[model samples]
Target: MSVQAQGREIRILALGDSLVAGYGLARGEGFVAQLEAALRARGIPARVLDGGVSGDTTAGGLARLDWALAETPDAAIVALGGNDGLRAIDPAATYANLDAILTRLAARNIPVLLAGMLAPPNLGAEYGAAFRDAYERLARAHDVVFYPFFLDGVAAEPALNQPDGIHPNARGVAVMVERILPAVERLIEKARS
Candidate 1:
């Protein structure tokens, strides 16, 4: 899709797992749609494509990198690894997958906004630390825009999530899109630059 329309539009790909997919919500309630609406409300024309897949791990995202990029995103929000953490996968492996994804995107001259994910507490402190560290290290190494945690204010709030507790509700998706908007504008700027 075209990145611009009326010289103000941007095409952003929301690439990740369930959170991006809006697991239990209706079509328009997903993160991608909500983010697009939010941007438009803010007078920033944008198209946030649905690149989310429920239950997808970072490895899965890495595998689909080329296809995701085929849409020619002006910028991308990388939100994978949540499923990896939930599955208690090796943090190093997750890191490698994310690193590869970022590397590939960079090679294609695409700007990226890396949204971070925390490992489930039940996985123990060591795993949690490694998981958290991976995002930071990758963001620094790749020099991409970073949002520390994608689920920030809505993670444990039952009122903000669906019955599943993991995936967000419609309202929760709005909150996420709100919180991430500024960073996304910065990402848009990066793409333009």
Candidate 2:
């Protein structure tokens, strides 16, 4: 709160997939937009750049890290890996890609919030364990903020998702923004310090 008095906007890179991209929602209804609105509502001078690509996997996110970094964020949110899980890619490869992404950001001294994704249950328990474990490791190794399960309150709830049942609608996005706000605020505080 009162972050605006610091005299510059806190730029946060929302790097991830359709969840961060706000796939089916209208322009302002997406994650970045709603998050920015929430930050502003709390009197924090911040802007959340949307680095989400509709179908991006962890590999895709690693591939485009430079492009997203072009915004020169003060802090970042890593929300990738959903596409990788959906595609049932090797968890090892997914872990490597995410590791690279986190490594790069760490090298640059940018604080990050690593948003975790759980593998679909149908993927089998072993796959799910390996997939979800990567986030924890990365968070500990890189010393980043970790918010487990990006779709925590919205996942599998028909009322919170769009017709496809994969992406959250506006209401669901609101829930996400609400739940993730504290972590983002902590990210902002870290940036200022």
Candidate 3:
């Protein structure tokens, strides 16, 4: 459906990496589909735009920001940076890209919910520390809402993760939607105001 048609409809752009794209899950099991269902179940009139791209990094997300914002979503859930952590990219760069994205969205008066990602412990203490702090720094600097860790309960859980051990399975996505729904609802409420 077109953005204009969704009058007073809470338009949410789920922008991020494979998790948001539901990489290993079926069409209906993906984040966008499941999030929309969750919102409906909560009696929130909303639409979730699937702006996820498989294997996308924060830098890549920055490059596509203009196109993604074309949907004119009332708010955006920035779920990127997972790929950056996987690739061990410099955390500073990730922060820069995310900061720019948030700045642009703010310029349009669009609220943002920044989804944070943690660097695996195996990535070493130094890298992990920097990477984990990046999200916090950005969120505080921009004064935007932040979810400390996207995979909070799902991350190392065998049952929740897919065979690849990277992306979440269908059940995991459900858990994520439930966990993040409250924050999302708050964002929508703020946007409406």
Candidate 4:
């Protein structure tokens, strides 16, 4: 699909933290760009709005939701909670923040695709379990599309991730886009409906 024909310029807000901000990579090499290219390749006319803020936690996302939604995206991809996990914040708080985001989006009649995050194992088994479960609970409760783990195929692999061992490299982001595209496509379809 040509750039102009992607769904009447359907707005897609990618709200998240450093990874979405493309921390160490050039602008075009980031997740949003790659995801946009992937969507266009699939003939989905869409534009990805960068709502990422470096160092943003779940609370930060909630704080900024009104401003982000002011852009009037047709759909939203909520990719937060990573920094919360890194800081080992309470899983319940994380869940509450995400639930609020999802609830607000639902109230707006905007489709959401929740991108889940996994707490680092160093945080301990109990913490890890609770953190992972929060995503599951929110997804089920909100009935939104859920990508179980954002960094599923790229997280720890030195070849796929950057030297920081946190964010994924361009190739890794491509892998992530491929894995999550189906769910995101469904979100777009829902939004269009």
Whole-model lDDT values for every prediction: 0.91, 0.92, 0.88, 0.91
Q: In model 2, where do residues sit more than 4 Å from their true spots?
A: 1-7
Q: Residue-wise lDDT of candidate 3 within 13-64, one digit each (tens)?
A: 9999899988978889988999999887766778899999998999999999
Residue ranges of candidate 3 with Cα displaced over 4 Å: 1-7
> Which ten contiguous residues of candidate 3 have the minimum total lDDT?
1-10
* Model 2, position 57: C-alpha lDDT score: 96
What are the RMSD figures for all models against the true structure? 2.7, 1.3, 3.6, 2.5
Q: Which stretches of candidate 4 lie over 4 Å from their true place?
A: 1-7
Candidate 1 segments whose C-alpha is farther than 4 A from its true place: 1-6
Q: For residue 67, what is the lDDT in candidate 4?
A: 98
Per-candidate total of colliding backbone pairs: 0, 0, 0, 2
Candidate 2 clash pair list: none
What root-mean-square deviation over C-alphas does model 3 reach? 3.6
TM-score, one value per model: 0.95, 0.96, 0.95, 0.95
Model 1 lDDT tens row, 18-105: 8998888998999999999888887778889889988899999999989988898988999999999999999999999999999998
lDDT of 4 by residue, 14-85 (tens): 999998898888889998999999888777778999999999999999999999999999999999999999
| Rank by lDDT (best first) | 2, 1, 4, 3
